[model samples]
Target chain A: MDKRAIGVFDSGLGGLTAVRRLHALMPQENIIYFGDTGRVPYGTRGRDIITKYARQDVAFLRQFDLKSIIIACNTVSAIALDLLSKENDIPIIGTVEPACRRAMTMTQTGRVGVIGTAATIRSGAYEKYLHKKDGTLDLFTQACPLFVPLVENGRVHRGDVVIETVVKEYLTPLKDAGVDTLILGCTHYPLLEEVIGDFMGPDVTLIDSGAEAANLASTQFDPNEGTGTTQYFVSDDPQGFNQLAELFLQEKVDVGAELVDISRY
Target chain B: MDKRAIGVFDSGLGGLTAVRRLHALMPQENIIYFGDTGRVPYGTRGRDIITKYARQDVAFLRQFDLKSIIIACNTVSAIALDLLSKENDIPIIGTVEPACRRAMTMTQTGRVGVIGTAATIRSGAYEKYLHKKDGTLDLFTQACPLFVPLVENGRVHRGDVVIETVVKEYLTPLKDAGVDTLILGCTHYPLLEEVIGDFMGPDVTLIDSGAEAANLASTQFDPNEGTGTTQYFVSDDPQGFNQLAELFLQEKVDVGAELVDISRY
Candidate 1:
C-alpha cells in the first residue's frame, strides 16, 4: 500500500485519455500526468530523437517519488520502452503488451489490424508481441502519420470532411484487408475514435491502447491509500490543456495545468 | 564580400524552401540550412517554448561563421526575430518584413490575406507589419495550423482530396473576404503553392515569405567566394531529408543531410 503518485506521460494530450480511464478505474489513486505538448507527434520522428525525448519525459516524471510509470505514447513504447523499463527501478509499463492482449480477446477472427505512427508500425513491436502469444494470428499494419495532426487540430468529428477523408484514406486499407480488430496504436488515435469507428463500421473492435494500458496499470501497482486527485503538467500550452482534455473527455474539467520545461529535465 | 555561409533555420523542413530560393538566387554563396525535424511543428506551442527553441535553432546555426541569419519560420519570425536579432552580432532577417514589402507592391485591391501557423497569426506580426506599411490596407489573417503536418506528410500535390479539402477550408474565408494578395506566411505553405493558387485563382498573387526573405538576404550579404555548394543539417530524419526536399522542389535532389542534436545547443 503505497501513497506515491502514479506517473503517466505521453507525447501530448493523448495521455489524458489514459488518465481519464485510469481515474475512472481507481478513484482513490493519485495520478501525475506529463504531456510533452511542446515537442509532440513523436510518431513522425526518428528512433534516436524519440528515445531521447522518452528518456527526458521519464526523467521529469521520476522527479516525483512515483509508485509506477506508464508510457502512454505508442512511439515511445515501440522505440524506447524496453530501455526505459530496464533503467527504472519501479514498475514501468508501456501500452503495447496490454493493447495486444486486449486485441486478442476482442478478435473472434485471427485477423488483427494495427494502426499507429510510422515508428510504431515500422518497429514491428505489435506483430512481434502478438506472434509470441499466438503464432497463428494474422496481422495487418498501417502507419497513419497524418492522424496525429488531424486529432491535434481538433478535427475529430463525424461529419468533418478533412477528418473523414483522412480516416477513410488510412482505415480503408485495414478495412479492405478484412481485419475484424483494429488497434489504435498511438494515444492520439483514440481522440479520432468516432471518425475511425464510423468509417470502419460496427463489426470491427477498436482497441484503445492507452486505455488498455491504464487498466493494466490499475491491476499491477496498488498505491492503496491515495487522495484520488490528479495533477497535470505540460511542456507547453498550459492554458489550452483543460480545453483540450475536455474535448477528449467530453466534460468540463476545471483542472489547471502547470507549465514545465521538460527539456530542462 | 563575406566568405562565411549565410545561416538559415526553421522548426523543420519549411526552412528548406528558403534554402532552395537562396541556393537559386546566390549559387556562389555558401549556405547552411538547419531544420529541427526532431521537434517540428513549433506553430502550436506557447511563446516561451517557441522562443527557447528559436534561440537554440539560431545558436546551432551560429556554430558556423555566418555573415547573416534568416528566420524562415513565421512563428519564430513573429515571436523571436527581434530578440534574436538584438542578441546576435550578424544581421537577422525574418519572413514577416520581406513578405510584407512584397505584398504591399502586389495588392491591387489594397486587400491582402495572411495564412500561417497559429502562433504566427496570433502574434499579429503580419498585421502589425502591413498596418505600419499602409494603415488603410484591408488585411485578413488565418492560422492554418495543419499546413505543416500536411506538407510534412507529403500531401502537397494537387488533386489530392485531403489537401484540397484542407486548402478550401482555410482559404475559402480569405477568398470570400476578397483578398487580392495572399501571404504564404509559413515556409511549409509554399510547397502547397499549386493547390493554393488553384483554389485562390489567378488574380490573387501568393507571396512566399521564405523566398522573399532569401531574396532579402541575397541583396544584403555577398559571401563572394563560395564553392557554389549547399550543405544540409537536421536534428532528425537524415535519410528522409533529400526525399522531402525533392517533393517540395520538384527535382531529384541527392544532397545527404547531417544530423545535429539541436537541443544540446
Candidate 2:
C-alpha cells in the first residue's frame, strides 16, 4: 500500500475543485496543492509559456515525495500534458481525457459541447480525444476568456448580472447547437455551474472535467490511513489563498500555507 | 540630442497607451515596446514576482540601444521603479510621479482620486508621492482589481452596460468624495477614458499617468528625425499581438513583431 501524497496543481485556485473531489474520493491520502496565483490565467498564454510554467509547477511539486501529479489546470492539461507526463515515472493525470470519456459515455445524442479557456479550446484536446474514441461524435467548442476572472473575483452566483451576462455571451451558441452533453472543460468553469446550468437549462448534462480526473486518480489508489498534514504551497503570498481556496474547495481548510519562489524550481 | 529608441514595457498591452502617446508626441523617435503578454496582469502578483518580471522585461529591452526606459505599468512603477532605476545609468521614468504632479497641479479642491490595480493602490505610491509633494492634499485611493481584465476583454466602450456597471461600481465613491482630479493610474485605465470620464463627469480632471510619463519623456528629448524601424517585441506569439496593440495603440502601425522567450533574460 503506497501512501505517497498526490501532487495537484493549477495556474491558480481553480484546481481546488479537483482537490475537493480528491478529498471526497480518497480521504486517506495526503494532498499537496500548488497554485500559481502570482501568474494566472494561463489560458491566454502561448503553448511554450504554458509548458514552461507547467514544468516549473511540476518541478515544485516533485520536491515532495509524490506518487503522482495532477494537472488540474485545463489549459495545461490540454496543451502540455504529454510533456509533463513524460517528466517522471509516476502516473500523471490530466483533466481532459477522463472528462472526454465521461462526456462520451453520458451523451446519448452524440452531441458534445466543450467550453474552456482560449488555450484549452484552441488546443482542440477535448475534441480530438472525443472524436478519436467515437468517429461519429459531433463536437462544439467555445472559449470563454472572461469566465476565469469573473469566477476568481467571486462574481459567480447564478443571479449575478455580470457573470450571467458573460456566461450567456459565451454559452448561447453551444446551447443552440442542441448539444445534450457539455463539458466544463476548465476547472474554473465548474464554479459558474449554477449560472451556466440556469442558462443551458436542465436538459444539458455538464461534465466537471477536474472532478472526473480526480475520480480517475482516486480509483487508481488503495485506501490508506491518513498521514501527513494537508500542506498548501503557493507562488503568491498566502494572505489571499484561504478565502479563494475555500470558495473553490467548498470546505474550511486549515489556513496554514507556505509561500514558495516557484521560478527557482 | 538622443537618437536611441525609448524602451517602454508593460506586463501586457496596456502600455500601448503610453506608446500611442509617445508616437504622437515624438513621431521622429523610434519607440521600442515590450509587452510580457505571456505573464501579464503583474498587478496581482507579489512584489518579488513583479520585480523579477520587471527586471526580465528591462533586461530584454536593454538588448536594444535604448536611451531611456518607461515603466508604463503602474504596478511596476509603484513597486520596482527605484530598484530598476538603480539597475542602469540611463534615465528611467515610471508612470507614478509625473501623474501625481499633474494631478496635484490640476486639483482645485485639494482632493484627488487614484484608481489602479490592487498592487498600485496597496503600494500607496501615488498617495505618498502626492502627499510628499503637498501635505494638505486630500487623496482617495481605490483598487479596481477587475478593471484590467474587463478592459482587456474589450468592454471599455462608454455606453456598454458591462463597462458602465463596472465603472459605476468602482468610481461612485470617488465621485461622492468630490475629488476634482482623478488619476488614471494604470496605463490600462486610460483605455477606458471615455467610460470613466462619463461616469465621473467632465468636472473631474482625469490624469492619464502613462501619457504624462510619455509626455515627460518626450519633453526631455530634442526632436530628431525618425530613426531605425519602430520595432515591437512580445513574450507571447505575435499572432495575437497586433490586434490587441491596435486596441491600445489607437492607431494603425506596421505590426511586424518578434516573439521572444523573455524568461531567458
Candidate 3:
C-alpha cells in the first residue's frame, strides 16, 4: 500500500472533469491538479508548442511527488504523450489511448467519429490508434476549435442559440459521414454534450475522454492511506481557475491555489 | 534617427491586425513581432497572469534592441500596460488608451458600447477612460469571449451561419442598450467585422482596437532609412503563427519566424 497523490493536468480547467471522476472512484487517493490558465486553449496551436507546454506541465506536477501523471488535455495527449513518457520516470497516462480503447469496444459497426481542437484532429492520433487496434475501422474527424472557448465562457446549453448554431455547423459533417459512435475528443467538449447530443440525434454514442481516463486511473489504483490528499496549482489566475472548477466538478472547491513560474519547469 | 525595430506583441495572433496596418502606414520601419501562440487567449485569464505573461513577451522582444513596444491585446492593455511599462525601459503603447480615445471622438449620441474578453470588460478600463474623457457620455459593456477563438479558426464571414448566429447572441444586449457607437475592444474582433456589422446594423459605428493602436504607432514613427524591417518571433509554432498572420493581414508575408523561450522573461 502506497499513499502518493495522483497528478492530473490540462491546458485549463477542463481536466477537473477527470479529477471529479477520480474523486468518485478513488475517494481516498489524493490529487494534485495544475491548469495552465494563463496560456490555455492548447488545441488550436502547433505540435511543437503543445509538446513544450506539456513537458512544463508534467514537470510542475512532478514537484508534488506524484505516483502517476495524467495528461488530461486531448490535444496534448495526442501530440505529446509519447515524448512526455520518455522524459519522465513515473507512470504516465494520456486521455487518447484509454478513450480510443473504450471507443473501439463500444463501436459495433467499426465506424467512429472524433471531434476536438484543430491541432488534435489534425494530429490524427485517434485515427492512428483506432486503426492499429482493428485496421478495418472507419474514422471521421472534425476540428471544432471554437468549442473550448465557448464552453469556458459559459455559453454551453441545449437552447443557447449561438452555441447550438455552432454545434450544428461543426457536427453536420461528422453526422453526414455516418458514424455510429462519436468521441468527445477534447475534455471541454463534454460540457457541451447536451448541445452535441441534440445535433447528432439519438443514434450516435458519445464517448467522454475524461471519463475514460478516470476509469483507467481506477484500475491502476494503489490503495494506500497516507498519500491521498488533493492539492491544486495554476500558472495564472487562481481566481478564474477556482471559478471554472465549479463547472468541471459540479461543486465549488476552495483550494488556495498558488501561482508558480511555469517556465522554470 | 533610430534604426532599431519597433517591437509589437499580443498573447496570440490578434496583434497581427496592428502589424498589418503598421506595414501599410510605415513601409520603411523595421518591425519585430512576438505572438505567444502556445499560451494564448489572454482575455479570459486574470490580471496578474496577464501582467506576468505580458512582461515576458516584452522582455523577449527587448533582445532585438527595439525602440518602441506596442501591446496590441486589449485585455493586456487594459489590465497590465502600466505595470508592463514600468518593468521595461522602452517606450510602450497599449490598445485601450488609443482605442478609448478614438471611441470618445467618434461617438455622436454620447452613448458608446464596448465588447471584449471577460477580463477586459470586468476591468472596466474603457468605461473609466470614456468617463474621464467626457463625464456626460454613457458606457455599455459586454464580454464576447468566443469571438477570438472563432476568428482565429477562420469562421468569420458575414454569410457564415455559425458566426452570424454567435454575433447576434453577443450583440443583442448591446443593441438593446441603444448605443450609437461600439468598440471592438479586442484586436481579434476585427476579423469578425462583417458578421458583427450585420448583427449590430450599419448605424452603430464599430471601433477596431488594432487600427487605433496602429494609428498610435504611426505617431511614434521615425523617418530613418534601411532601419525598418519586420522580424517575427514566437514562443511556439511558427507555422501556425504564419497561417494566422495570413488571416489577420489578408496579405501573404514571408516572415521567417524564430522561436524564443518566453518563460524566462
Q: Which pairs, if any, clash in model 3?
A: A3-A227, A30-A228, A30-A229, A39-B39, B29-B228, B30-B228, B30-B229, B31-B229
Query: Model 2 chain A — which ten-residue stretch has the worst lDDT?
Result: A221-230
Off by over 4 Å in 3: A222-228, A252-256
Model 1 residue B15 CA deviation in Å: 1.2
Over the stretch B123-224, how does candidate 2's per-residue lDDT look in tens digits? 989877887889999999999988999988898886677778878998999999999999998999888889999989989999999999999998898876
Scored against the true structure, residue B260 in model 2 reaches a CA lDDT of: 89
Look at candidate 2 and tell me the lDDT of residue A46: 86
- State the lDDT of candidate 1 residue by residue for B1-265, as single tens digits: 7788888888878888888888788889888888888888899888999999999999999888888989989999999989998999999999999999999998999999999999999999999988987999999999998888888888888889889998999899999999999999999998898999999999999999999999998889754677877788999989987678887555688878899988799
Across all candidates, what is each one's fraction of true contacts kept? Answer: 0.90, 0.60, 0.95
| Model 3 lDDT per residue over A1-265, tens place | 5578889999888898898888888888989989887678788777877887888899889888778998888999999888988988988989999998988988888889999988998998998898888899999899887788888878887777778888888889888988889999898988998889888888889999988998898898765565446788888888767766888888867767778778778
User: Model 2, which residues run further than 4 Å from truth?
Assistant: none
User: What order do you get sorting by lDDT, best first?
Assistant: 1, 2, 3
lDDT of 1: 0.89
Q: What's the ranking of the predictions by DockQ, best on top?
A: 1, 3, 2
Q: Can you write out model 2's per-residue Cα lDDT over A1-265, one digit (the tens) per residue?
A: 7888999999988898998888888888898999998778799888988999999999999989988999998999999999887778999999999999899889999999999999999998987888889999999999999998888888988667788888888888989999999999999988888889999999899999999999999888887687645788898867788767789878777657789888788
Question: A-chain TM-score per prediction?
Answer: 0.97, 0.98, 0.97
